[model samples]
Target chain A: MIEGIATLATLGFTLGLFLALAARFLKVEADPIVDDITAMLPGSNCGQCGFAGCGQAAEAMAEGTATLDICPPGGKGLIENLAARLGVDWDFSNSTTNTVPMLAYVQEATCIGCTRCFKACPTDAIIGAPKQMHSVIDSACNGCTLCIDVCPTECLQMVEVKTTLTNWRWNKPLPLAQLPLAA
Target chain B: MPKLSIRGGVHPDEHKLTNEITITRVPTPERLYLPLKQHIGAPAAPDKVIHEIIHKGQIIARAQGSVSANIHAPCSGYVEQITDWAAPHPSGLPTRTMVLVNDGRELRDDVSTPVNPLFLRPEVIAERVSQAGIVGLGGATFPSAVKLTLGQSRNTPVLIINGCECEPYLTCDDRLMQERTQAVMDGIQLLAQALYGPDTIIAIERNKPEAIRLMEIACKDFGNIRVMAVPTRYPMGSEKQLIEYITGRQVPAGKLSADIGVTLHNISTAYAISNAVRHGKPLTHRIVTVAGDAVKRPGNYEVPIGMLISDLLAFCGLKEEPQRILMGGPMMGQALPHAEIPITKGCNGVLAMSRAEVKNSTEHPCIRCASCVDACPIGLSPLTMAAMLKKDKLDQAVDIGLKDCILCGSCSFACPSAIPLVHYFNYGKGELLIRGQQQQKDDEIKRLIQGRQVRMAQQEKEKEEMIAKRMQAIAKRKAAEKAAAEQNSEKEIA
Candidate 1:
């Protein structure tokens, strides 16, 4: 029992020493603020921010290599939040323009029932069997536009989503003096 | 005795002042404004041209889709205009309307000869009902022909005629049952005949003893027909609750009454159906209960469809300046911004309530008292749903049975804190729908980008293959030339 205990202690000590050495050699000194910035991003990995992904964008921002308002999908809201969180002075005018929300529609007349677009969809929003017409599950889609380039028949087209009565909000009324004259 | 009841409901004050009054037929108005979208589905497409003279009961607009119902002119007149007007919706948005100016002469288009419903096939009865443009008069306004077809297809065994005018201020159904009892029974029999001999049952709330007694006496001759008075409950008129109370069967969520071998029709709808099948008349008029404290005359009136609310209120004698003008019962009715909106088939009551009747209490935060939970008929967690919706977490709200809500307004009425639960649920539903549309658009953009990448990669592969083939061909030509030159040298040396 004593010999077994000694061997276990020695093994634990040796492993601990080896781990300490490896940690010193291979440790990646990352800024803690990078993770905070990454959390603030949309995490869609759309690459519209001119980086490999959201993670790289966050890293570039932390290192001062990239500006605060590079994400088009994030819009003004993200820029404001990021600037406030990072304590940086960001020019509101230099922010990337927001892209309008669009939905992909398959032009059935031109579609050859090719399943290539369906296979390329990352969100599993496009549904169909081989050689069958595919339809997008609009609720599940993240607006990535990954499936369009793979469509062999060039049948897919992006359309701006229409606002329905249910989703329509009352617009803020202008001041009485600024209102247009009655026709 | 345990009262025959559904799971959860609230008993509001029953202000039924017009229950005893007989229905009075109103004189045809000078003008009638009919909104094309009286029913739930797509609005009917207008076929009549402007300035065209049309007779009473003439088809002004055709049904746009299978789910839509036709719109008929209520009075013989010239089509003044086909324009957008304030519709009888909660939003009060402008919808396509047919404006007809009544020409004093009540000339109705000739209807076909009435056929005995007994000999006619079920399909023929359904077609006749559809042609009459009859819809559910119980405030749902779903096309009655669709419900009849569904009942026939499902082979429903029981036909429940709902005479339970359970809404507090609505008494048109009660008055109809008390006065025209035979007509309502005949309508039920006709509906049963259309559904291939289903057992007919007439259900009336216990609050209206006279209606119950009259209906019982009317159905005594028919051996298969039964008239039962259910306990007076706020929403016993709800098809699901009524079906459960009478049949002792709970309709599964998302399924219709026909799915459970039962068909439910409102008593007013049955009355209309009987009129259409036996009398060869179309549904151009309905008994509207014009009641509220603000009105001088509070009673049921046989008002022609497309009559404006303002005209009805004037005819009823507005006692004081009306504080609120509701299109239906106070519980489920929409409070109109103005009284110019016209009445439709679904409008059973128009309450021009005074300030005293309108609760002007400020909404308070929910105290988690579970009063709404107790009042919810569908047994949903209104508190949790409201909390999630408040945080703009619509997906989480929907995950916890948001779609199952019937918008009965019980939760709002029963809340001690007055949280406006129904409004929160409606807002959540609308936001979720918008999110769904946005997601679809996002998916489309992703698909386009992916397609472009694939096309570019294919082109690159093709270009690489072409260059490799050309390089191989040039190498083969050079090897052939070197071999030929070496052979020539050897021959010259020899």
Candidate 2:
């Protein structure tokens, strides 16, 4: 029985040693980054980001190749993740500090016959062509700055178009509002 | 009155006269300018050089990454020039487009190469989807490959196909379900096979009875797949809302649908998948609903990717003049000042309304009507959030569930006073993110400052100690010299 136990112990130790050696030899120098980047993400995978997807974006973020603020859809969740992953300080004060949802508007009178803005918009939010008045295709527009930079006649404007009844949301009032006694 | 909703939301006349009509195909244009960026994600990059001969479904541009969708040649044509031009965007931005001058033959090349996707691994299927440039054609344009990967990793148990074309005046999905029901069902079957036979459910709003019937019949043989009708409500097509209505699951804010063992894909996306899998075709042309009050002939037509809105309007027989052209439905669609914009994959409808149809009521202050409160699907207070955003109190707004606002435009649509409530929520959300980013930066700077001060103080202490030691050594040397001089003088006197 003792001999049998010894043999078993020897086999277990041998297997453990082999595993340790293999682990050392085959150690993938995974950019200690991919996991770090994954943690920083909002993890919604909403695809508002332009990467192949959030996983691809996370991989890119880990590799230190992709921009930190590329995800406008993930917005702050994305920014925070990127900041944590890179261990860098983020200064959004000058970088469009307010996250006010921007909408595309056109100065109908100023629009020239050129269709510059239509081609520039990433979401195909604008509709118009050469020698004609241009318009904004609202539903597909994500308010990316690609369209604003493409207008030749400066006809397209990124206006904080007021959210009307058609777009307004009903936010739950604070606890104080529900209690007339408190007021 | 079936619990008539109150608060914020505009009842743009449904104008769904064209909803029941069948989809028609538009003839090839003289020159088709295809934009690389169509979806909400990363813009695609062109693979072909200037003046390259390209066939239909030949991917003109490749999706940059998982977030980006692929771009394909809409027709068999010679590439003219890869130039930057104004695209169909509200920003009136110039984007890189592959200009293809049609040869006028309208001859479609056989780019469809069948692949036995059934035998391949789920990861392999996802890789093929990525290569095919598939995306959510539901206007979000999220890459399909990434979604599949998420489902694979998370062990998704169900696949919910969104056939609920809830937006008024949009009937593209309805037409797709009616005309291509089998294809959609086939795509779902393939998706199920990829996910180890997860139950597939097609969720259609009750209003689209024809679509529900067609989809149900198509999936009759597949016991795992079923068709369920949800309430006919606005934004019933939203990813979160649809999941809740069908499965009683609410995908938490900042979490994916896979987290709840559910995978949601749009109906058009399923059809695209079928085309890619069976026909070996990449996404090129899509069904677009061209309807509004001003058009003489309002109908749904299958259009190429880069056709001008003007051509589509003319084909529909434009009335005297349109007051505005909006892409998508009236409630959530963006307004186009001109009709020069090119349609992309996400574009579902082209609305040209007469001035009479678009006389939006003037904006008024919220009267605390509590109508918006009732309209909120997520149970948010739109007015409070808007007010906080107005005061630049972003943190306060966030505390009140600003993150939950889906921006479905339902609250805004429900508002009688024409208040832009959704705009405020969007603004608040954006501001909260910006402030959080700023705080992160400030914290980083503060740490750097503290580290530098500690180092500087240590260096000062070291310098002072060195100086003190040197002074003590010099005093010792002087004392030794004085003692030697005094001893020498005493010897000379003796």
Candidate 3:
């Protein structure tokens, strides 16, 4: 019985060694970019990029299949992170460049008081019901511009809310100013 | 009740009253202000001379690159002024613009059939689209040609048409479906032909039964295409959401719909495609929904691109001075500083609101009600993210999955506290980006400084070595000279 046990252990060890050797021989070169791109991402599986999750987004980024500006919910932060990590330049101006933060508003009176739009909103930004005036959840709007297209009463509109000092953040400067800001 | 969601999104009240009256084209304004940069990507450089007489559909601005869209004269008019003006920007900053004084001729002289896209290759089709200034009229304003190219290169299997106008107070698309059904479908057919054969699907919200019925009927004859009614949801009209909802497949982040063998085009874009292809017309005008509580006459108008918001409001018979003038739908729209800004390709709706509608509710602290979380379609904790962002700990926010946020406004909409959670995210994102840029610059500088120091040290070492070798050679020569002198003296003595 002891001899049989020894034989079994030997067989297991031999099989393990063979598997390890096969793995080494079959190794395909992995693109190191996957790790870099993954690190750049928010790591949240929000599926905001139309993907299944953030990990999938990272994979796509490594594959060069998606644009760096694909994340709308991530907004400018994601774009900047991606640009920095990928060593790419990105224009972020609002007039002609990407990364302008936008909000959504609903036309209240014209809303027909139907909850169709409320139901259609993925973010539940609209608050009202059938036979009641609907209002926009202004703070939560992602500015994806999806909701503006579906209103039966033509009540939904994507108006850019004015960016005041209350909501303003200092813009990122050109690369010449490499020093970190004083906290 | 817990609201349903599928992906990144927000719900805003759809104030569509301004457009609910009926469809009417505002009488041509005395002057039309056309912005040189109307579409997405780079703005086209003005090609025409400052005062050169231009007609409708005349290419005033040509596409500069693959990402840029073209710009055309909306009506026959003379360039009155070419100057910078406050555009409809969140920052309320002025941008370069072109103002035109309308001759009220409504002239469209430059009309002719271009090379038929059907007979031409896909590449030719793309070129014509580029020339037509065609963009995704669905508010994205992305160049149609680029989308087409992306689809062709990746061999996208299915084309999804977005018909989910879920935002409140905007019914331009809905009306377009109701009124221009045939034109829209024709546009869809052209898009399909341009893309992968006729394997197309029209994704309409179940709420728009009429639109669904019309689209279904229109597409019935086209065996390769069909209409699909997605469950009505805010941001359901989003490309990612619609794609996932329809195909049950999620397009990975950092990837495109084409990567998953799918491509999406707006119904309006399809219409533009048809207009550009069949009518041989450049994208000069589109259907805009003018809606709000303040306007006496509200409805959809086939307004030309670059028309001012003031003219539109006046033409509609201003019932009251609006408290807010918004471009696009309320949920995802932007509030205009005033009505001076001209319309662009991405403008789909204009809303005028009374003081009452614009009044802000008193904001309160969060009660930990978990309402925002419940309302979030992508299933995110808005309260936590907002708190982290408030503390200026963007990295921690990111650690909590900040990248996954869709900014759909559901949380804010559901928040009883009236906290601008989405705005906070935007702020946090902006701050984070600034920090990232600074970090990148620092790293680059460090690399350069290190390289310079290393080179300087190497040069110093080389100089010292050269001096030492020279001194040694000189000493050897002196010693040889002394030896030779001594030998000469000895010879003389002998």
Taking all chains together, each candidate's TM-score versus the true structure is 0.71, 0.65, 0.66
- C-alpha lDDT of candidate 1 relative to the true structure: 0.83
Better of 2 and 3 by DockQ: 3
lDDT of 2 by residue, B1-494 (tens): 12232223334345668767888999978888788877767788888888888777677887775588778787887899998766666545577777888887666666635466666677777776777788888888788888898888888998988988888999888888888788888778777776777888888877788888888888888889998876667777878877776777668888888999998888888888877876677777888998888999888899988898888888889886998899887767777758877887888999998888876766765789878887887888888888877755565677888888877788888888778887777667655555565456434433533454566689899999989988988998889888888888988887
Candidate number that wins on lDDT, 1 or 3 = 1
Off by over 4 Å in 1: A1-183, B1-3, B437-494
Off by over 4 Å in 2: A1-183, B1-13, B106-112, B115-120, B430-494
Per-residue lDDT over A134-172 for candidate 2, one digit per residue giving the tens place of the 0 to 100 score? 887654444555666667767677776364322333343
Model 1 in CAPRI terms: which quality? incorrect
Please state the error at residue A20 of candidate 3 in Å: 48
C-alpha lDDT values of all predictions: 0.83, 0.75, 0.74
Taking the tens digit of each residue's C-alpha lDDT, what string does model 3 give over A60-148?
87677987777654566667567667776656543233455556677766778867766555454568877988887765455555566
Residues B1-494 of candidate 1 have per-residue lDDT tens digits of 22458778889999998888889999889999998888878889987999999998888988887888888888998999999898886667787899999997989867775556767899989998998889999999999999999988889999998988888989999999888988888888889889998888888889999988888888888888888888887788999888888888878988888889999999999999999898878899999999989999999999999999999889999889999999999888888889999999999999999988889766666689999999998899999998876655555677888988887889999998777788887776665555565455544545654665677789999999999999999999999899989999989988
DockQ of each: 0.06, 0.02, 0.04
Share of reference contacts found in each model: 0.04, 0.00, 0.07
Q: After best superposition, candidate 2 residue A17: deviation in angstroms?
A: 60
Ten residues in sequence with the least summed lDDT for candidate 3 chain B: B441-450
- Which candidate leads the pack in lDDT? 1
Model 3 stretches astray by more than 4 angstroms: A1-183, B1-22, B114-119, B436-494
lDDT of 2: 0.75
